[model samples]
Target: MDATLWKNSSFLKLWLAQLTANIGDQCYSFALLWYLLQATKSGTALSLLAIPEMAAGLMFYLTGGVLADRYSPRLLMAGTDAARIVVVISVGVMASFGVGQFGFFLAAQFLLGVFSSLFQPARTVALKSILPLELLGRANGILDTTFRSIRILAPMTIGLLAGSVPLSALFFANAASYLVSVFFVLTIRDSLKGKGGSTASKLTLGQYKRDIATGASELRHTRDLFYILLFGNLGYLVWLVTYNVGFPFLAERMDQGNGSTLAMLMGFYGIGNLLGSLYMARACYTRHLLVVLIGWMMQAAGFLLLTGGPAFHWLAFLGAALAGVGGPLIGIPSVTAIQVKATDANVGKVYAINMLMYTCCGMLSSCLGALWLGKLPVERLFLVSGLALVLLTVVGLAVEKRNHTTKHHSLDL
Candidate 1:
């Protein structure tokens, strides 16, 4: 990791922008989700909120990839933020004016999702350009940790203002954050935005198809990235989806619907995640997959402990913290590998492919989480999650061993 990472002004600007934006996003989500649950009195509505976003990612990720690779990432990022501001403001206006329709909210979610899909690829491209490859892991760590922290603090802060503040306030705050984000993004030097892969006239139908094919080929040939994207992330999916949907239920069952307990568990998880990300930022490694598998194993053990958590409060906090620590272990290395290994020309497209995988799996996991929560006990769900991680870890270890052996034999020859 670069010791001067803290001194890098361009990266700092980007980091600050991301920090403010994520905090706003957290606030908006907390406010809107509460509204939905109150309006519909259905967990299904909460689940439904994620659907349109995933739908947009599925539909637009490829196109977003093409554009990011073919244009100025700086412009794309700023433009996306500008568009988000409008969408968020629109949502607030509708709510303030007494609009009660759920579909209207879903439509707003879909539009925001579109910008998210675009911004994600562009953001990666921008990051790769901002700093050298050596600092990439630490940068990713900074962003991930900030996001996790906001996930913990933002909701609680909103809860504190429940009666004093209006829900529309969250929406407007989110828009303002985006407005600030756009300003920071534009302030970045123009020379830093890497040139696009194709000219406007060259991006014809046949060329677009070829560009997509090229990115797919690049990803298929990248062994580490392919494995992490497919299997390692699958394990992470188990941890993220199950825990998110299960936490409130655990709180309900264990404490007789106490919100404080839920908040406490989340705090432990967030703190652990912060520490793990800091570790990844300072630590160095060439075998990214090993770090990811180790993370999964740690989380698996945490989940196993969590099966006994509801019965014992100490175990619950300990388990949540351990699981939280595993997240950055899996995430930072995977992202760094892409930033370092993927060809510069294809980096955006490759990242888009990665995000697309997340979108598809996210939708599946959301449904499975809802189904499992309805049918299985919370203890059993934690057990299943833990066991699933154990399975993924075993498979990943086997693959790593085989790859190492193959490389050694070829060297000997």
Candidate 2:
């Protein structure tokens, strides 16, 4: 519970590794997008880049989860980090030779996605293994804050670099960052159980199936955790729809609908997110349901304000900030709940499934928003999704309360 979580050398090393890798990935992503736009001048080019990446990630997540549970996360993570370094460096080499084709970039993106899927489950398990139970919440808060902070700055930083540095240099820089992360990962000594047991035997298909089943069984047994995850994923879907699709459309419709205004909106949201992350790192909230409920409501308010309705158009920035603040309120507690409830044996699967659901939600939002954006006004979408989120949050809280009371009454009887 001490706020000085960095005192733990293992956690510090893991955090640094993750930080470096995240920044590098962001830069790589920005560079890829920029290159695609300049080369193709078609929206389909972006889709071609994103869809394959998403598909690769989705296809590998469950397998990654199983591997995370079956093997040493430290080794798995390091290996994947090394693999990505090779992939990125290869791409950089190709770029240096004037081979910046869409197909080449797509291949690199897909490889990165595959490696990322493998890395994520392992990273989650590794973090849990290194950090104590009491510090999970704080560590998660700090990590989330760090990621958000990077997101806020990475685009701008990369944009500045895009003007001065070649895409090949950016790719090489990303590879170098991953190489640094590999060093940090190798330095950490994981005290996780069953470290060397993974290499002892060949895994049969039946065994792999059984491992995945056990993970699913673990979730099925934890009823509260399951419901929380369900609501959390759905909430994420709604948030994604509003933010990704609705925000840009609304911004364009607003007066002075320029890049600067849109950037200001995002900047405000990032500041709020940064503050929220810092707040959660320092303070502990015992009631997760209340936290989630408050977060959803705040998020809903933000979305509604973003609707750009009469007399409320100027308050859109405030809405963005509220949404940012509300996000960590839900995310940190939800992750803590899962980590606390899951056994080490099933933790990897739980985290994997959790990530898969979140990713799928984003995909669903993107697809559905695309379909709806053409037929309806963007403000209506924002308002509806916001209200729906509010309703879902209320329902989730009520269900949890009833379950709590029912269990208590049955115990009394």
Candidate 3:
């Protein structure tokens, strides 16, 4: 871990932009989710809110990857940021004018999700370009810590204003954050530095198909990386879907559904994430496989704890904290592994594919979990989540052992 990460002005600028944008995203989400729960008190409604965004990701994620490989990431990022600012502010203004229809918000969310999906591949590739390969883990850890810390403060801010301020105000604040992010992105000088794989080639249909095929080939051959992407992110899906639906429903049942209470719940989770990521930044681990396995189990434990959280507020808090700690343990290493495995030419496509998988799983969880909300108890759902993680961890361990022995046997032969 290089202590001089701050010395790279370009990386710092990119990091700051991401931090600000993430903070704004948290604020916008906290405000909108709390508003929906207050208005409809339906788990289905909350899940429905995220559908458009996920749909957009599903539709455009691969295309975004293609664009990232073809053009300058800095320009792509800036364009998306500008579009996001316009769309977010428009939503805020429309809300202020009493156009408070849910459908209207849905349209806004769709646009936001589109720009967000487009931005991700560029952002991932840009970050890789800005830092050395040796420093990737620490860089990922530090960034994760900062991002989680922002989540803590963003929710806290929403809590503070829940009763006193209009929810629409947060939307405008989010637009302002996008404007700030744009400025920082424009300041970056090397968006094209990592353009070795495909420079100056026109993106024809044939070329696009070839690039997709190439990326798929790389993933198929890299078994370790492939397993991590497929199995490791299952935890992310379960955690995201269960918590997003369960927490609010549970909080509302306990009469703690107000913005402030929700803030406390999310804030504690953020604190746990921040602390865990900080530790990851300082510690060096030779066995990423072990780290990923432990992280999944830890998440399982946290979800099990959360099953009892509504009955015991302290238990829920503890559950949130545990889940937070598990976040960086799983996430940072997965990202670092992907970066390490991908070559310069294919990194954008690989990252896009990764995001595509993540969003697809998240969407399925949200939709299915929403439908199940009425039939299954939230506690039961959480219990199932815990069990699923346990199952995944065991499977991952078995797979690792099988692969390890096969390699050894091959060497002996």
Candidate 4:
């Protein structure tokens, strides 16, 4: 990792923008969850928030991806941020007026999800434009570590403020964060140049449909990429289930408050992620594919320990740390690989599909885990997650080996 990338004005601007936006997102999430709990006090209502938000985000991702590839990422991101400011302000106004309508909150969340769907793909594509390919891993590591580190402070601060501060204050703060992000994003000149030529002249619903079809066909033909996405999605599923179910269960068993231990464990996890990302930034590796595989394996091992035994409190911390470490190792590489390997014309669609798969799996897993919580032991949930990881790893390794053998044979020919 070159320290020089930090000096690159474009990269610094985008990085700062992302950091600001993420902090605001964390604050909003914490505030909203607290608001929901205060209003309803029902687990079902709180869980439902994830449903519409996740579904709407996934449903729009492909469209968002298409737009990202066809247009300027800087413009797309700025536009989305501007839109979010409106939504956040509106929600803040409604909440300030003592409007406790669940439907209104849900609608606001859905709209935010839609904007997020568009923002993510465009932001991802913009990263490639800012940093050299050789430095992508390091850059991404820095980004992830910063985000994770902030998670430690953001949620608690939001919670503390929730008591005395009006919810509108948090919403206004969120809007301000978006404005700050947009200002920084506007400073990046390269992202404004756009990729490929404008397809607006020929743009139509049919053109989008054709693009999706073409992108899907290309993805289907790329078996290695497909498997990578599949394993990644599965890993997301397991992680989501463990996070949603196992934490509370373990907390109950330990006689600790439901969220206290989990929060502490998460702090340790954040530290681990920071450390792991730092290591990856400096490590010499030809490709991150191996790192992705290893990361998943470690995540699975961590889940096993987290869900394993009553005596495994220490194990839970270790597991959380491992899971955190595994994330950036896999995430940075997988995203960079997709961006580099996919045709620039279809990168948005590919990234959209990737996000949809992961989000859908996570959503589904959360629902299932919620449903199964009463019938399943916490340990069993961990065991199941570990088993799923092991299966995914075995399949990935087998496929990778075959690909290597085929390459060697082709070279001999």
Candidate 5:
């Protein structure tokens, strides 16, 4: 658990590339939402932007996982980055010409999602291939911290600049970041070898499907891991619902200006994540599974505070900070566990399934939140969801502890 494990050149390149791309992503997202709001002024229109992306992600992620297992991850990373660059550049040009329709934007997002679905699984696997097992935790910690730090800066910067600059400018910047990411990925020497026996031998579609089924069955059998993954997905759902649906409405209720206050709050949350990641990096314990459970509890408490009453209004920032703490605790360790436990042969498939779970949760939460909008106050929704999360966490901890005790007793006998 040496912190210096993150000093590897390969890890550094990948981490830096991800950091740059994520910053651009944050900037583009805020700018895109602002443009849509100004153009349509309808919640439906704003929500539609998410649909194509989510559908594309859901449709392609499993296939992406299969491909990652079959091909060289370095090549996949480079190619996907290049594809994203083209898509972003096209969006920039179209917007600059005042010809960027909502449909066209949606298409861009969908295509980006397709490429991203492929890129992410490969990227995750590639990091494991590059870093040693012992350093995985530290590498993940650094990676998360870098991404969070960029998120902290990107939104506020984009919000400040969006009014002065055209949306096209943000798109152009995003495109450049992707191209830069490609360069950095290219510099990484580590490449993934196919785990499905010979790369020279091709599998039929049926064979491929069978392999995926086998992988799925293996995942289902790992009961503790499955529950942990489920909790991660549920945590993500709560986060998306609260942040995407609740926060915007709450900002409006508080009479915060469009985008500015939201940006500021996100920055604060990023600060919390940054600090939390740093703390995690120096952490000496190996009981990250338990840490994730505790983190969820902390998040639930934070949400409850947010939902409590007028007296808790002053704690909104604290709530955000606590939620931020929960994220890396869950996200970093959950990923590490999968990487550590999954056989190299099925790593891609496992990671893909994990990604699907989280993405589906996000989509479900957003859809549910959309339905709940205008039906109840945002604070009330937060209260309900927060309580639900607390209960879930408690149950999860109990199950985990029981499993631990049973295993210990079996070993003793």
Candidate 6:
């Protein structure tokens, strides 16, 4: 349980590939949302952007895991990256030509989501295949820290680039990053050979269904892991809506009333996220559920700080930083726990089930974000969600405390 994942060549290559692609993705998302903010002047539009993507992932994640188990993850990763290049480019072209239609973005998001649903489980399969059980936590921590660090800088770059460049250019950059990812992913040896692709062509629909069920069954049998993933992500679902939809609107109420201010505030959050992951990377987490609850507790405290009244920018920024610090606390441990607990034969499936739950929650959050933003002030939404999260975390803490005392299948790292 050491942070020595740097020595793993295959993981390094894949991490590099993901790193570049994530940078581009961060840029594209910022520009696209800013563009939509200007074009529609609606928080609903920004929130709606994720719904199609989540729905697509929800429908296909399990199947994608099945495919990953039966086929070559390298091929799946490379091919999906290549396909996303086309999909992202198309969105860029349409937007460049003055098509501000939300429906087009929705369609593009659906297509991109489909590609991602395939790529992600394959990525997990590749990661687990390459690394050992002990290194999984460190690997997750390093990866999360890097991704969060990107969140720190990418927005400022996007903010600087905002008036100077066309938003379509950001899209093009994302497409190119995917191309880069495809290159590195192609270079990774198909370690799942002899087991996976050897019989891929022979896989039938019945087997596909069975694979899905088997994954679900395995997840349920891994009781502690399954419940932890579920509750931890439920906390995140609220944060996703508040951050993505509420933050944009919150910026409008602030001093400059511009995207740059929002970018700066989010950058602070990224700074906090970076610090949290760095600590987790060096530490060993034996009780992942406790780690997740602690994250929720920090976030709850931050959210509760909102005077339950005015939307003060200073307070908002501080809360964002606190919430950011909590993210990796929740994310890294749960992912490592999943990887450590699941057998290799069904790891892809279990990971896909996790994604499926996340996507489903994401879809729900998208609707909630859009529906609620118009009905209530952004501050009120944050306050309420924060309160609910606090309640959930408290219940989880009580249950976990009882579970530990009872020794009800207590997981020891």
All candidates: TM-score: 0.92, 0.93, 0.86, 0.92, 0.90, 0.86
User: Tens digit of lDDT per residue, candidate 1, span 19-136?
Assistant: 8899889878887887777777887777778779888999888888887777878889999999999999998888677676899999999999999999988888788888888788
- Report backbone clashes per prediction: 0, 0, 0, 0, 0, 0
lDDT of 4 by residue, 37-72 (tens): 878888788878866778777789998888887788
lDDT of 3 by residue, 1-413 (tens): 56578888888898899998998888788877876676667777776787798889888888788787777888889999999999988877875665646787788899988998889888877888888777777888888888877776677677887678788898888999999999999898765465643466888999989988888888889887888787767776677777787777766645556666666777777778888899888767645666888888888888899888778878888887897788788888877777777877777788878888887777677777767777887788889889999999999989877876787899999
Candidate 2 structure quality by residue, lDDT tens digits, 1-413: 46468888888999899899889988888876776687778888887777777888788888888888778888888999999999988877876776657888888888888988998888777878887787888888888888988988898888888888788788888888899899999888764555544563566899888888998899999887787677777887778767877777777776446766677777888898898888887767555666767778888888888776324666788888888898888788778777777888887788778878888988988878777876888778878988998898889889878867887899999
Best by lDDT: 1
Q: Which tens-of-lDDT digit does each residue in 1-413 have in candidate 5?
A: 46366567887789878988888888678867777787677778887887887888899888877777777788788899999889988877876787737888889889998998999888878978887777777777877877777776677688888889878899889988888899999898755443323462476899789768866886898775676677767777767888777766766665444666565556566777788788777665455557778778877877776664234545766777777777778888778777776777667788889889988888888778878879998789779878888987888788888877886898999
Clashing pairs in 4: none
Error of 6 at 281 (Å): 2.2
Q: For candidate 2, give the lDDT of residue 261.
A: 64
Clashing pairs in 5: none
| Predicted structure 5: lDDT | 0.77
Ranking by lDDT: 1, 2, 3, 6, 4, 5
Q: What is the TM-score of candidate 5? A: 0.90
- Find the candidate with the highest TM-score and give its number: 2
Alpha carbon deviation, residue 232, candidate 3 (Å): 1.3
lDDT of 2 at 286: 57
Better of 3 and 5 by lDDT: 3
Better of 4 and 6 by TM-score: 4
Where does model 1 exceed 4 Å of error? 1-3, 37-42, 191-193, 196-201, 408-413
* lDDT of candidate model 3 versus the reference: 0.80
Error of 5 at 48 (Å): 2.0
